[model samples]
Target: MAHLEPLDPKVDSIRILTLLPRVDNPNSKELFCKLENRTLASKPKYEALSHAWGPGQATDTIFINGQKVVIRPRLHDALRSLQTGKGRSLWIDALCINMEDTKERNDHVNMMSYIYSRATKVLAYLGPSHSAFNKADMKEMGESYHYFSERNCQLISKSIYWTRRWTIQELIQAKEIRFHLGKGYFTLDNRFNSLSNASNGSWLDDHLERIENHRNNMHSHLQQLEVLLEMFKDLECEDTRDKIFSLLGVADDTAQELIEADYDVDYYQLYASLIDYHQSASPLQCRSDLFRSSTYDPEPWRENWQGFDVSIERSVRVIAFSNLVQKTLNSAVNQTPIPESLSLGDPIIARGVIIGSVMSIGETYDDYVSSWESNKKWKALLESTYKKDKDLAKWRENDAAFYQEMLKWDHSEVAAIQSCDTTKSYGYRESQDDEHITREALDSVTEGAQPRRFLGTKGLMGFLPPGAKEGDQICSFWEACFGVVVRKLSEDRWMIVGRATVSKESLTPAVTESVYHDALNYGTENTSYSSLLSRTGDEFWAKQKDLAYEALIFFKLDIPTLQKLTA
Candidate 1:
């Protein structure tokens, strides 16, 4: 009906050039028009018949005007074959094969996902889409042949293998942490490894001092010195005497230096009392006791030799100094207990008292408890597990109900899926009605009691309640549906924290099924698919929250821990 215009020779030359191997052909201005008309033209009833063939015989193509675009030989042959077949025209790349051309191959390879996305029915070809296979074989094979064979070796070399290795291989091949092993057991990057192995640096001196002060005390140091002296008493001869003198500061030089200087204690009895005192005190007690015992031993007064009153005075002075030192030592041994409130029924307060009391004796609570409870049968079991596994104690100590609920919910959801009958649920009344009709027919013939007509379930049958059905309560109910709130404390974000189950019912059926049925319909029709997923999303998150709350009640965690988490 419209006038035909003559085509320019220059335009015709350009159109022909577009189909060549390396020609840069701009996209047709009318390409969008063809795309938009695709759905409209692709309806099954309006499909063209090839005298005997179905819509499947046609090849889908983007006709710029009306001329057939001259693509490569393989694709051209495929299009021609599709034009004669009974199968619906699927414009996917697997159907069109220009396997010889690298450039065309690369372009198509990138668009594979898009090709499947746009297809009327993505004929996920199993082996071959056109292959005449039986239904059994097709089902078994799956729709694997639908994927286009990728021959873009450059893309594979550059993008897939090289890029993937650069991103992920290092992490996958990295070393694991074995803290119980030697110091260099775990190795990550060179920097991290170096950081771990670095010295007990100058920055740590203050911390070291604090730690030393915490454990070091005058009375314990004195006790240790006595033990060390007893150990040295078993050593032999003049060498032992010199070594003892050097250790106790009676000698000027260390044993190694004295050996180098050829120093030896010839008159061992002159320092006999010093050696005896050093032998009495331990190693820890030796250094502190050195000055008073050996270095500053005063001689007896001249009057003491003649048995005069001066002898009594010298004895009295000695006794007074000894008494003073003994009193100071005794006071040091009796340390003050850390002040703390022993509030009744408070587990933290009880645990604190236990921890503080035990920590006074040992380096850590674990070390102290391991020693204190070693004889118990429960200790054997705990050690057996704790030695082999780190998480074992945590697993046992955790609320048993947390895992129990997880397994319970997992099985319940699985069972719910297995028991579901979609057709029956969707058409419950119709199916029941048909069943009753068939039963009545059979009953009349057999002369049994007449079968009754099927009646709908008691609660819901499109019947309105005594009042309105949809209102604020219903909207509020939907709003409160299963979801989790991720609350942020410092921020003013009011997140509905934790997993919640705000369904029509939980663990039990609702008292009124009418509200429940309406909610179910609303959920199925109105809610997004993400809102309905079973696990790991809003619904599952909400459920987890509720389960956590149940665990808190069941486990009876202390108020402080609970308050801290919720806050």
Candidate 2:
């Protein structure tokens, strides 16, 4: 027999070894010894090897047997602790990749699977495994890993080289050994006691117990290896077609859905650009960093559009406010009470209810903004409407007790609005009368108040008292309605009349011209504004406006007005 030293000399604590069969061929044995004694005489030129290789080359790293080595980072730490100041040999896959050694790298890639299989105590240093492994940690988790990556997974090829794929079959076979199959084994601590208990003449128990424990540990290690193998199988094969198909199929659907939604145009554009780049990618050529670009910022467009939206929304709020006010005025105008009909205070109650409803639109919007973290424009719209309603609540005639009672009804309406999940009855109830009233208010306030172009008006029936304070210049009765009539009614000339709610405010001469201008220039707002004027003989206006107003009484004003109007 030829005298030879073992490939590595770092072994002291480990007693176990894998037996390799001697081959008949002298060259095969030489190659096997070379593979086994993977340690270099000196540091090999890695840069030359890496430079010679083209893309898609097989690569691997070799570790010498009996070498005190760390497979991964924490294992390096653990192995260092085992060393006593002597240079402990460590075989790291990263250091051995030989990036510059193209021929060696290519040859090593094909042998990686075999090299890893023969390794003793392959340390899977997943994370800093010098400490206990917490599988849940995001940074350290090796729960699942991509096998053949070209970009971020630069070290993946080396990792596969160190795994013992062939030994997994042996480990699976080891699971059925007597010690594991039966309860014939003791734990590591109990081995000594078990051996002492068994007589020297009957050493079967001690041997069987030790074998069982080894089998159990081997079984556990085998399971982990099987999972790791699954990551590497077919990774470097030509049949990468299936993987491409699987990934690309779902990606196409998601891209199509995003495009169809048309919600974020810039995001979709960026996604499409990335998809186009990926479809024509070469092996390992797809760089993850290239796709990490942000979509074009829509901040400028958002800012500009927000201004228009806010102006429109403000117009809507003003319309709603004017509507509430007009309803109060109309209610005060038609204060004729009926017996067995609901009290004047009942219509007084409805005015508050509708006011609460409109305010609740503001409240619902506020809640939406808060819940969705919507932008400031939406928040401002809700907040402004809320503030205006609060201001309106301060004014009153001589109905202090009635106003207090109305507050309860208003609260109930608000509660109902809050409970409503849909837009239909969030603030305004879904009644034919309420719908007509809202539409009429939107039309009328937008129309008749052009010079000081009010958004809209609300109507009620009772007449206002003549000695009304400016604050009490709001109608508060069964027949009363309210609206955000334009501020064009000059402070000096606008006079409060009966019940202190009616106001005779003169319009500027530009009222008709402004209404026409707005209608012609601004489509919806201006057209609706012009329609509010009551032409002396325009029977269509008279009928349509009156019919709409009368219908609103059924839902919002007092039960008497509803009964009379419907009657």
Candidate 3:
């Protein structure tokens, strides 16, 4: 391998690979390439490579400047495909960044956003092409709608190329993007144009249209963070911290400040900082125009808010009321009496409305034992055994022995039952019933401590606050996705118990009414809950109210109006 030059931090310099064209032989052991370092200030024109570094240990040999150089198999394939009759200039990370040098890696990473954004074009490599699309077939499918609908393309969409945290910014920040599928390259823009030319009104076109529209609707940095977290939650990275750091370049300026990329910081600290930033950020604002205007829907907002399934109608109503309240505040500022139809005493008028609640508080230890025994048919078997033997004492005394004899159990069970006389033990015994057993164990443990499992109005689950008993209200700010567990400290005050999760399902009207009543009953006697709002401050409350109102108003709109607004 040719001696690689160290990157000079004094000036912005990057290595561009000069890919040699393929020879006639297909089984050639080696490929040739040349690496040249150039300063970005000179405006070097080169295509950037965007790909997932699959299985770090798997590498292929390539000839760089007539010397053997080791490179990732994926990158070697990319170079072989991208090379043409004339050598192609490409800036690939594996070849470009000096991986052995930590300082070089850091500098290169920090400059990555700018590097990709300034690239002449970005070739998104989605690994080897599926056997379904050979050279002849690929040639015919070029820029066609069929090309995108191909199984290979679908695989490309789900590829690690699209899932990596670092590539999110790479794709979004690129000056232009092209897909390298095996040996074939194509542009999505060409596919869209081809579909437009056909005007066939196919489902593909409709889907593409939605995607284009969504892409056009650019999100703010904070909003992008929310989207990234949800979209890439399942993505893997060697360094857990890279999950957040990789996003800094593409993230909005404000969000970047919230989480500056620091490899030295622990991953948990990085995550905590992000949550803290979100919590401290001002609540959503209610736009009066959103209520009066017919073009609002709450789906986008709700999706952004929690990235969970939400009730469109309920979200819209909450937003409408929030917007209405904003108007009322405006009217009061102008010395006008609030409209009678929208009076403060109206049924809808409340400090905050319950959006969701926990499905079950939690199962007690007794409940857990009963459920398990019932599920396993142990209750009946034990009863029949006692009746047949006519010996209840033996049944109770040798319960573990009887359980082991009755059913095929595992080592864990044997251990758990043995420890039953001492410490608590719980775990899944089978793969199929793993989820069920895990949930039961979790519920049982929490319930044992008198912790009630409650859901936020918006469908989140968490425990009630410490010292919070059952039936205590779970309350949350309209702008906040999570809720708090609280009980009336007095007629006028409410004691904070701690945090609780939002429920996945919407609460029934009766449940909603009951929650409202509980809050109102205390609210009317004393301003404790009102003071709760005050704790977050009037500015924060107002902002939350506005967001809630906009969502509600959007929910009330007709489908056509909603589509038009979103469109």
lDDT of each: 0.22, 0.25, 0.47
TM-score of each: 0.13, 0.17, 0.56
lDDT of 2 by residue, 13-113 (tens): 11121222334553231111111234434332111100001124333222234332223333222222222223223333333444344444433433332
Compared to the true structure, candidate 2 yields what TM-score? 0.17
Model 3 weakest 10-residue run by lDDT: 417-426
Q: What is the lDDT of residue 427 in candidate 3?
A: 15
How many clashes (backbone atoms < 3 Å, residues ≥3 apart in a chain or on different chains) does model 3 have? 34
10 residues in a row with least lDDT, candidate 1 = 350-359
Off by over 4 Å in 1: 1-36, 39-66, 80-87, 92-120, 124-567
In angstroms, the error of model 3 at 528 is 12
What tens-digit string does per-residue lDDT give for candidate 1 at 1-567?
011122232321100111112123332211110101132223321111011111133344434234433333333332333232132333333224243544444344333323332333321111112222232322111212111112211111121111111111112111221110101111122223233344432222232232233224322332232232332332222223223322222112122221221122222221222322322322122331322234322243122223332212221122112222222222221122212331112211000000000000111212322354522433343344345454555434431333233234432222111111011111110011211111111112222211110001111111111111111011111112221112111221111111222122221222222222222222232333234333344443353342221111001112222111111
Candidate 2 least-lDDT 10 residues: 45-54
By TM-score, the best candidate is 3
- The numbered model that scores best in lDDT is 3
